[model samples]
Target: MLSVHLLTLIALVTSAKAAISPFTSRPRLQTTFSGLSDVEPFSLRLSPDTAKVCNSTTPGTSGFITADDGQGGNNSIFFWAFESKHDAKTDPVILWMSGGPGASSVGYGNLMELGPCRIASEGGYTVDNEFGWNVNATILFVDQPVGVGYSRGQRIPTGLRDSSLAMLRFLRQFMTAFPELADRDFYIAGESYGGSWVPALASTILRSESRSSGQRGALMVQEDGPNLSPNSRRGPKINLKGIMIGNGLVRRSVQNIGFFETVCSGPASLFNSSQCLEWAPRAMWCEDNLAVCEVDGMKSSACKDAESKCSAISKVVVEDMHLNPYDFRRECHDPDSCYSEMRHIDEYLNRSDVKMALGVPENEPFVGISLDVFKQWEEVGDLWRASDEYVNHLLQSGIRVLIYVGDKDLYCNAAGMRLLVDRGLSWHGQPIIRLRELVPWYLGTKSAGLWKSYEPLTYAEVAGAGHLVPFDKPEEALTLINSWIHGRLPAL
Candidate 1:
């Protein structure tokens, strides 16, 4: 059975805590900000065991940016914008979000994947990740749509429209908060349900009415306050350069085709060909139901049935096969998060001192995935609708996009992502990408992944990696991203 917060959402937005023992919280002092206006860099002590020998500096600014929750009052979106280890002024900014419709980016994206620090599971401490994404870019890991992670909102994230708008409002506030980094090239990235988030936010940014160079927006002082007046601060347009998705879920029906192939006939199939054949009929039913739901409302009963049945397929793998949905290589220890390391991360983030340093609300629990966020999203049947059309919009706008998947993932499997890239996504570049073949992309003379690109859109598959590619293959993940941002992925 699934744990309360542990149902899908990718890594978190859930309720389970790690069951590890003997690792008690160690107290450490950290600078706290009184307001959302402060942008001074803050540092955290890395290790508690050997403070002197292993202590390292992880410099970043953490705080909340208030937005209007659709229900009135205000929504506080928490973000940790980590400074680039290389160049703070000139390096690109990467805004990273986690999926699950309710998952916290802090758990899945930052502490686990490309963040500067990695939390140790055994001793419940921290270590510097030399391959952190901050090595070349300023990465902001946001716990958004209001109630995820350290953020406390007036209500749960109800739908994609609301969540994306909140993200836009958060970015406006983010620009006002950090003017020094305003004009820097910005890119958005996410995984799982973030597939829906990344494109929606990008599209909203493209579609928002305020596109002028000189635009100032008001700021709300409190979490339960009214709208910002004209006497506040400035918010410049984001220099949104590109988008990157790791093991993303874009097209529901097309990805369904990929799912069947992943388990049945793909290069990384977990089930035998004969075993996969038995499940083919249900896959077809899911695809048909989703098609009908698209014509009916996204929240229609037909769509709900399809969503329920499709989820049952994954339930089989998790329950009967005893494998994690994010990464089949691991056992599903926690229902929502699928990994025990997530529990340690949960325990670490909830530590009093850590919360104090981050200036999180004293009582707000650090949920990996909020069941509240998930239930609200599902009730509306929003999960079945596809976001690939938004991907096409980004491509047409001349913004670059990188879609990389971990081969071992089950939920947003590599095969499905590839299928979406090939014929599933509807764009002018669709035909161009469909005809191209994936060539080997090397990591120091050894093959790490297969990639094919035609500018604006680059699709790759990370070898042996799972749902969270950066978490499973940090070095390769970094190399893939650094290559994509700086230049094309070199064949040599």
Candidate 2:
């Protein structure tokens, strides 16, 4: 599927490797500040033979491990930093987190999608990728919650709600381990469920910094109380310039109920024969649609052979597929067709050393989490909501929050994202229009539209991208991110 021009760009970029030092016999432990005796200094040795597949022109490897503060916890945080061939010292740091309160960052965020090096099926050699994010920034692909990636932890929490606690401990350990990065300008970015993690972590860092005079200050107090400091406070009061969430799941209640009905109801009515299908109803219609047409999920005997004539519903079953109440794709959709692209990406991910560094097993099952974890995740789904207070706190502090959505992703589509932004942002009247256009600039032949509109915060739709924007349009994504960081709204 890669074009000749893209392949040519890859070839051009793949041959350059002088930007990064060759693997040394000793690890490189470059520190910035002194007087941190409690923390042990460590160096990183990048695998020399590892191929750089993301950009064919930049000769680079896949992974490197960095030490981080676990924050009073016994576990140590280890992160994978992807360097750019352009320049390391001056390059901005883009910290990437993948969604999945339980997914591996290196697997999903790095090798398969955004980071500099992607996994190549041939000989494990790295190729240059023209669309890699490293053309402008140094990406730190992190696996949080301890037991993630190569980082070790005593226990994996059974529910998704425990993600915040895990991240707090991880950030503490991460900062402690890499005291050198304490003052770097950083941006927290992610996709899917990470919509929650990025903002929550940013807020945590801000609160942590607000407490003390210097970087090592005490955690900030919560908005509510004096003695009972909620699990919210922890981490550095980061000079967090901005945040980007692609296809995130931060506004759960509104997204699932309000947006779901609006976009899917019309399609559902086209396939279902039941007159019971009324707009704005607070119930799911699986049986009516199945009785009328061959809708996938409602084929059980309960809907079969019933002479209850119903209207034919469309074959598109987005909501039911998501709310199947099961983590297994087989339980939700036709296994033969469900996640075919994801499975291919997974195949490449399993074979990469980048994945190994993140502690994701090559042969691990598609549904990585245990059944107990899934059940707990369901019970605690509400915990992922980002409160109005937190959003307000950031805006009050002048932090820029950018929430982006991929129109094609059923799980966290643009419609849901728009609803969330409208609800959270306090903008009166029509939101300020920053920029907009359907342009042809990236590798793809038919160009996608790019819109940059802001009202203190900016929300835009990255056309043609799925749940993962970078994977779908890496060059455009990188360009947009670079423009935003530089305080310039992108012009489509």
Candidate 3:
């Protein structure tokens, strides 16, 4: 349930619904870049009325792309781009992904989180989003992993590596189509399972760039020929600068070790000390088993069996409490409507006029979440894998990384995030340690959060926010991102 204060903030950001603009009169916007010419048929201009809701004159573009790249066959990924309200040439491009390992960035990042427009459910239209992250950069929302949201395909990528490869291919084509974004500073942000997805994708991009530049060595060629090297021919390199993950499941070991500790004794642990103490031995057991599973040359069967035991230890808490694992502050309700406003986004997107305006095929139904994608990964045993090493690679390669979480979130709590960054990962053979103690971060006078940094890596705890930091503390989320992009630490 939304608090009175949050509801007030929502009202301030959303305008009373305006009448819908005529779809027939809206001019078709075409991309002049040759890379995008092939995708011209899928483009649609957002209505003037919707543009007004964003309090900007810039019209947005929404379309579908067959992000095949010959590797993933043909997966149609749905995307929507809101060009900077300011200058496109000067602004950075930020790609946003949502976790579920199967979630839709379109549904979570765009309508429910940081995008510039909010759906006014009562009025059945969109309204301005004052705390929108687009104030400083061009934000791209994608429905990914092949089967999430509007992205449709015969088969979805099962593991993180395959999915990241698919994303890399899609991004190459995306940058080619929108050449202006090719040179702009780029960053990827995501939450939840995104902790794994973002790192995997960043690792893919970084490795691709490194291999293409011949930084490591000669690109390995397969039996076929020189063309056998995947890096032999590559598209334009993306200007990736940094990455941010909120309440992510980046490393299973750290998450598992810290889970019982956080819930039993940390700042807002819901369990009694006795209960937490009882779970302590089990946590260590799970952690130790995972350590063995992570050993080099370990068998997949051994890993799968160990992971099952590890998860069983954690699942006990989730099953026993019946509390929202995402946010301990509340009881678990309808998973879909847990964050009530999310339901409104569904209503807004499902509108026939809204779908037509966005160039979605008239008969294709929109799905906010895809269970098929999730179950497939479970079957393939890809859910409990880790991406900490990949993130470490990015950190060593000089890409800035930010790991943050809502202190109030139970699943990916701030304590766990702090543990992962400080103790779990090593950079250049040394543990990542904070240069300074956690300090207050404010949006004006209000202390909105606490932050600490180790130069290129930073960790933060949003004070009252939950799993969805942006939605719970919009002002602070915006400030945190702005400070990050500008290469400055967030301060008063």
Candidate 4:
């Protein structure tokens, strides 16, 4: 059973509810960006509660795209698309996803983080987020893996490989619906668990694009198993310009160790050198299990042991040290109600009128994250396995990649991100990565963080931010992405 704390994160992420059962029969449906028609009607407006009280300066729409994941069943992904404030017709396209293996992108990623509007207060109201990502680029927030949020499908996928394949199928359907994006510069971005999803999806897109397009890179990843059917081998390239990941959990072993290292490294250290020595044996065991988990995919006993080992470290930090796993600088106030905004966000989304405006059934319960989906992923040991090989391949293929981490986040902290760049990847740029000096990255007049860049890769650490950097430092996060998408790397 999941701990009370774990279940209570429901508030931070979204409402809590059971996962929707797979449909025995799916509807014959089709949709388009130009016009909303067919099985699902589309609406280009938020609820009255949003418009009446929120400073929603941009226009957006909600719709669903149904696609059959050739592996087993058909999938329908729900999406919220916000047009660019500057010029939607000419701006680049951004594909955003939230990171819980089962988290709602529209729930936490949208309302809580970088969405066009934020939860207003204790009641059901919303306020404008001046730093919303759509300021210059159109953003598509997708609820994925078939069961998170309003998405529905044949079944939840088993591992990173299957989940990614499902997302690839979704993208093909997405491209068919939004033809205007066919030639636009595109970027795939996500955080946390998205660490695996982003790289896996990018690799598939590069490897599976219509071979005639010639944009297909010769990507060979371990996740693209031999069972992949040739007929299921098409993806949307969309002039993929780059990818951005924030505090990603791409390499679990390094991050797991980094968590402990963080508590023992600074002036505010919770464990001194001698105290840290006690965990040396346990750390060794954790690394050994992770190595087995890496090679075994989802079915190894070692992987479950590894998961326990990793969670042990987190438990110590949160329970014993009394520190918040996501933001180590803060004390663990209450796992169930650490942030009051979460509860209000949940209440606002569950409103009948709000659901109606978003084209969702008024009676269907809203869940921010699905425990059932999370359990499915955990059973297969997906979280412990590494997606390093895929990310490394993408880097070597000359795809522009930006990896950023919050300095204060211990969950997927900066130390781990740095190790991922140094030890997890092998590429042409690896030779000079260490030789280059890191420089201060400024948001405007003051330095917000530190960064380093070489054409294909840029890595940075945002100061004074937590696991959700965008939520904690909205202005800085906006400046970071604006600079990145506009080709002004290492400068905000």
Which pairs of residues have clashing backbones in candidate 4? none
Off by over 4 Å in 2: 1-22, 26-73, 120-127, 157-181, 215-237, 257-280, 283-376, 379-389, 425-447, 450-452
Cand. 4 TM to true fold: 0.82
What overall lDDT, based on C-alpha atoms, would model 4 receive against the true structure? 0.69
- List per-candidate RMSD values in Å: 10.0, 12.1, 10.3, 11.3
Task: Give the deviation of candidate 4 from the true structure as CA RMSD.
Answer: 11.3
Best by lDDT: 1
TM-scores for the candidates: 0.83, 0.65, 0.82, 0.82
Overall local distance difference test of candidate 3: 0.69
lDDT of 2: 0.49
Tens-digit lDDT track for model 2 on 1-492?
A: 000001122234442311234332222322211122222222222433333223344433333333433443344344556555466555666778887665667556766677666655442444446667778776676656555544454555544435565555444434433333444577888887677677777777677556645334322211112222223223333356767777787744345433343344455322243433442242234322322322222233443432122111111343343321111112345522344434554555455563543333445332321233334454553334344345556666777777776655555666557666665344331243322322333324444544445544766677667667787677668766777777764543
Backbone clashes for every candidate come to 13, 41, 0, 0
- Clash count for candidate 3 is 0
* Ten residues in sequence with the least summed lDDT for candidate 1: 1-10
List residue ranges in candidate 3 displaced over 4 A: 1-59, 67-73, 121-123, 213-235, 266-268, 296-320, 429-436
Clashes of 4: 0
After best superposition, candidate 2 residue 59: deviation in angstroms? 7.6
TM-score of 1: 0.83
Better TM-score candidate (1, 3): 1
